[model samples]
Target: MKQITVGVDASSESRAAVRWAGAEATRRQQPLHLVHLWLTHGRTAQAIPHEEALLRAAQRLLQEAEADVRARFPGVRVTSELVTADSPDALVTTGGDPAHNDLLVLGSQGLGAVPGYLLGSVGLHTVAHAGCPVALVRGAEDPARLGDGPGPVAIGVSTRPGHEPVLEFAFSTAARYGTPLLAVHAASRHPALIGRDELEHHAAADHDAEQFHETLRPWRDRFPAVHVVEHLSHGSPARAVLDVAPGAGLLVVGRGHHAALGPRIGPVAHAAIHHALCPVVTVPHG
Candidate 1:
């Protein structure tokens, strides 16, 4: 059976992620796997005097998380695992594989002193290279707030060719939740249109309007029940999406893996992941 896997540590952020994953697994009727990585500080056998105690403490953390999830979400089948991974990359490599998990969920930041409190190194790495979609639980993560309420499931629709998976996920989520789907496309001011006449500006807006309608046609047919609202905003892509994100229940964006190394997420995705007021899901495409 497929599982909704969440990485856990001794942080409040990790506990929040567990709660979010538990609610999701219960809704989807999938098993919830709470995995904790035991990272050793040094190569030597006697790296620290309290090695045994640390290991025992980690085990207790996993057990407590599992029990809490099971109790809070009675329908969710919860399981815990203690995986020994030496590096952050190794943990992402193992847990992010789609063959092992359906959706990998992580906290915005884990238990560490790493910089960028919004997204630690592990969360950023996994989002960029994960085989499946990575969900970063953020903002008002209390278990009470995780519900199929009124707000729409929004996605930043890219005109770039390879965003089919992103659209499918967004539409399906909105359909499942019985909420509307908001598709936003930001039309950046073209360099060619610099100092152009009013007619040219109107022409650019018209062209973008046409493209937005054309792109959404097939998807509307595919998921007829999803009420989709298309918005063509005039500004930076990230700002456009962020504007509509406040009232949105969930925000979905595609990760543009166009480069060969480093900085996995594109600017828009990175901004949304860090700044969106709601939960942000990064669906890898291209």
Candidate 2:
């Protein structure tokens, strides 16, 4: 069966991620997998002692993480693994397989000396390339509190096509948690510019509103239990989503279509992962 997989390390952020993933697994009635990666390079015959000590340390960390998850979430079926790798690619590969994994959760750490920012290279790469949805959790968040309360789930709705996955994930999550769903779409023009031409802008906004409603119509019918609040705004999509994020418990954004060169994350997703107050999930589309 598909399981929820998370990357665990020594960082407090990683511990937070484990808690969040454990809660999600309990909610979904799915197994939880914890992965810890360690570098095994520079292990020469002469450095056998050092290598042995490093491996033992990695094993100990993995065991502790597994024990913590098991203690906190006894109902969840938990499994763990320790991989000798140079990077977090093992975790990415394991969680990116849609057939085997439902979602990949990773810890997001702030840049040194930077305030109110997160998402390092590992997060960016995983969010960009993972086939499954990815959730980035920060150290400061209280997973238990967020999981117990009914906070709005906000999603950035794009005017373009191929956002079905994003919508589906957002609606389903809201329905599952019995929380309100905020569908926000932002027009490219500024509010002032829109005001300059009242009639034209009103007509444009009306059209956009209708389009947004139509886009969500099917999802609404599919998830009638979810209470959706449509929001139409002007200016940056990233800013629009961020403005509502503080009140939301979870933020959902879409990873742009894979380019000919490679998969890439959109600006909105990048910003949300780095700065959103709540846990942010990036759903891959197209």
Candidate 1 residue lDDT tens string, 3-107: 888998887778878888887887778998888977664557675777788889999999999999978899988888888876776656666787877788887
71, model 1: CA deviation in Å?
0.8
TM-score of 1: 0.92
CA lDDT, every model vs. true structure: 0.82, 0.84
Cα shift from native, residue 123, model 2 (Å): 2.3
Residue-level lDDT tens digits of model 2 in 36-141? 8665554578877687777788789889989988898899999998867666566578777788989999888854578756876666777888899999888888
Clashes of each: 0, 0
TM-scores, one per candidate: 0.92, 0.91
Give the residue spans of candidate 1 off by over 4 A. 41-47, 109-116, 147-150
